[model samples]
Target: MPPAPDDRPGPSRNLAVDFCGVSRSYGRVRAVAGLDLRIAEGEVVALLGPNGAGKSTTLDMVLGLTDPDTGTARVLGTTPADAVRHGRVGAVLQTGELLPHVTVGELVELVAALHDRPLGVDDALRTAGIGDLRSRRTTALSGGQVQRVRFAVALVGDPVLLVLDEPTASLDVASRAALWETIRGQAQAGRTILFATHHLEEADTYADRIVLLARGQVVADGPVTELTGATRGRTLRATVPGADLDRLSALPGVRTAEARGEAVVLHCTDSDRALRALLSTGPSARDIEVTGADLTDAFLALTADPPR
Candidate 1:
């Protein structure tokens, strides 16, 4: 008797996904240029970048849907195609076209049948939070429901590594949050996951590490806290009558300052110093408040090009 699918070899202890000197080009445009990224087993990593940043191309290479023009893309100590063929890899790409007539349950079960060893259909459904929608026709489901079903399909293979491309792109706030919880749960279960998204909050909140891409190259890579801290600080807001916004902007530890009605908003590197300066130099300074930087601020500042 053959080993069950669940008994197949799991992801190796080494890299789950590795790109070495990989490059791809289309006509006159370069999609990925001399890229190198290594994702270890059982890690949750986010590939973050704006449009035209080669994120999709990188995922494509990892999925074996496209070949790198110059170098190697490896998964699980083997080619991506080999890993996928052995049921070690699973993915939810940006676009999915579910059959209209099949119920969600049937669709997922069908996908499970294609793999050597797969999770029980019901288990996949429950994991994806779509068990209640099992009987619903695929065509009748809402966008979020469709995504959930697709996630179930991805899990049916019981893959060791999962890839999701902008899984929450079309979801509303509530759906996005719900799906994020599911993804986090998967990561916590020791499954390696790689997702690509432009949402700063998603990367910051859910991933163990963030790999920031720019113009087809890795611009930053590190733990979420360190990467965000590199570009983030406290913000100071105060109601200062007849505020000298220019002077405030030039204050020590203040990155930028602007006036909004009677309030001056300051993006600060050192909030304590900024506040001290405000009180000592400006007679009208009052109603001062300081806030820690959120992901949005860090993302923008990190992605911004530095002065020449």
Candidate 2:
């Protein structure tokens, strides 16, 4: 007997996700506006935006939890819902209560049973770094442990594309590190990963590319280095007791100055000139370090509000 259409593999495509002219709204608020994005297969892309900036809405559309009012969203060369039904898309969402009274292993097994080509329960648990927690009840797990269980559930499907929304939320430093290590391994295995995170450093370090949303649209999209390099300035940090921020801001090369305790941070177009001026003046700056703009700087610059 032949397999059903849905049971067959999707056509091969270089892009894992493609959204064109997509828009969505709730009441009078527009969540996403003509957003066009494309993520290549095997790429680890970070989706970044402030609260209410449409990150969640966009992810929801991709997961087929919500439909766009216009345009289209395709995953794995098919509609999002179709891809999901074929067990080609897996997600680790931020919200949702685990099944009560079920052991971690049981919950994972149950999810795996729904998929046509799910990974082994033990393999999923091991991949998610929760092999030992299989016997623990879901209700008895810690926040981090619950997150790991969610990861296991998502991995059980062995999806071609993974969507993670705040995957490291509620996790401690060590747990966060462990989860990212697993994620990196999965990415290396040729799975496409799309994750949204508030941790700027995580995106800066892990993502192969970044797509930043603002006011329901893409404001910046590029490699981490490319976006940060576009910010076009150096940040100088130095210890200057009783620093006068106004004076520092007035420096020929300085664009802005902010004081943090005994240290003053200067955003400068010309760090060499700024450093010379700072030292020549009375404050007696010391322990100076000048570095180029980073992801945080790029994010702030790109997401700032537009003038009326």
Candidate 3:
């Protein structure tokens, strides 16, 4: 709608995706609205949003199962449907979408055979971390195990672009970490990967760029550092001489200030900003310290939006 991709310097120079006011709607509910975005090659972008925030819809558009009623989605310079058949694009959708009656091995082979040159059954299984589950029926595998099979399907094609929608859902922390490692391995292999998830920390810990979406539109997009800022004002303990920490807590954008031991640990938007305010509090200010706000604090501050 807005980008007018056909009017640009063609797909080769444009972003991996060229969405100008792209949107999809069913009846009165708009799953996605007029949205414009660009994803470059080899970019690992994590889509983060609340439930029903259109994350799944966005992935579907990228996968070509659902087309936008308004605007369009281009995967790696090609329409998602054509991209699947010709361009390099892979996706593990929310539904798993596995053929229940087939053994994992058969499914793997079927997908691999789609390409003129595909990975060996053994190699796909090995790469997908499901070598041991080759003979298992797709319907019988555990969620994590099935998830691995889904990856095997997406990956066996050797697509240049990979889309994972909530790839770590229903996984425990350990499983989630293992899944992350696997995805990182793919990224290391230089695949342009885009994963959608609700977990901020996972996006922070794994993705190269965090693309935040809300209410059917992109709210923020950038490297973790760019979105959060330097230092992130780490969570630090500050020992101050004052009992009235409310003045310190009330500092603008200071998320929380709690007294611990002889100091206080503050979670805030700008740790530097918070630090400066705490230091100026009359004679009661003493021993002000600083620490780093991990991804949580950074994400919290970045995604913060005024009430609509």
Candidate 4:
């Protein structure tokens, strides 16, 4: 989820975010390769990858915090810097030290004041689920609370494009879910959101689209369903007590089979064939369930690289 590298060409007058042949590197390591991507208004997109995958670098370009060595990063059809200056872009970066002395309310209010057109401090706080904590000093809040406060600071600008870099890292399940709810509300109201996350479920459940980055390039791009089904297969789970694991693994259409306690799980290239074979051979295979491959499966299949 570190800094990395997209592309599309020409002026996309109405797109929320545009990256055209964008590439950035540090010394000999290319963080982002030539990449092009376009995000429409009101869409929730996730940039997904592992460490050093260039997710952060790509976001930095979009936020105008770092210049691309080649190509351009645009927000709302303008340079990221211009859009940021006009309060049309807001960002929550992965790492930063919050100001020590200010109260949460004061912090949000200060950011709101910087924008010519800004959301009210109270409104931002409410949207970020931190309205009650507004009076707490920045130094006094827990890590999760502090993160929500940072979200409030970004939301105070009422930006059209919200860019977040690993916004939910290290939070407990409850905190992550809470933050996602606030994000979902913001997106529902027509703001375009682009967030980078290592959590596969976050990308699969929340994003309208997923851009899978590996080593500065996109290994996959599409809807969650499409990516999950990228392997052209289905998964079948069935309860078969005392089943013959070796026989199940040898089923004609099944690519792999494993025992999950009292159940047998099958990854199959042909579901119809596999199902028929299972029911015919394993008469005891009951409580059958069929589902497509999930994002985690697809990610491993697609991003598995050859040994260097």
Model number with the top lDDT:
2
lDDT of 1 by residue, 1-308 (tens): 11233432345447898888999999889999999898888778899987888999998889888899998899988998898888888888997588778999889888999999999999999999988988999999899988898899889999999999999988999999999999889988878999999888888788878888877998887776667677768999999888878999988889899888888899998999888888888967889889887667766776666688
Once superposed on the true structure, which residue ranges of model 4 sit more than 4 Å away at CA?
1-13, 239-247, 279-284, 306-308
Give each model a TM-score: 0.88, 0.91, 0.81, 0.87
| Per-residue alpha-carbon lDDT of candidate 4 for residues 1-308, written as tens digits (9 for 90 to 100) | 11112232235436988888899999999999987888877778899987998999999888888899998777788898898999999899998978889899988888898999899888999988988998888999888988888888888998998999989988899999999999999888988899999999988778888999888888888788778778777889999877887888889899888988888899898888999999898788799999887788888877778588
> Backbone clashes per model, in order?
1, 0, 5, 13
So what's the TM-score on candidate 2?
0.91
Q: What are the per-residue Cα lDDT tens digits for candidate 2 across 103-159?
A: 999999999999998999999999999889988989998999888898888889999
lDDT of each: 0.86, 0.89, 0.78, 0.86
lDDT of 2 at 28: 97
Error of 3 at 223 (Å): 0.6
Q: 2 or 3: which has the higher lDDT? A: 2
lDDT of 4 at 167: 90
lDDT of 3 by residue, 141-213 (tens): 8888988899888888888889999998998888889988999998888887889987888888888777777
**TM-score of candidate 3 on Cα atoms, chains taken together:** 0.81
- List ranges where model 3 is wrong by over 4 Å: 1-14, 230-242, 245-289, 292-294
The TM-score obtained by model 4 is: 0.87
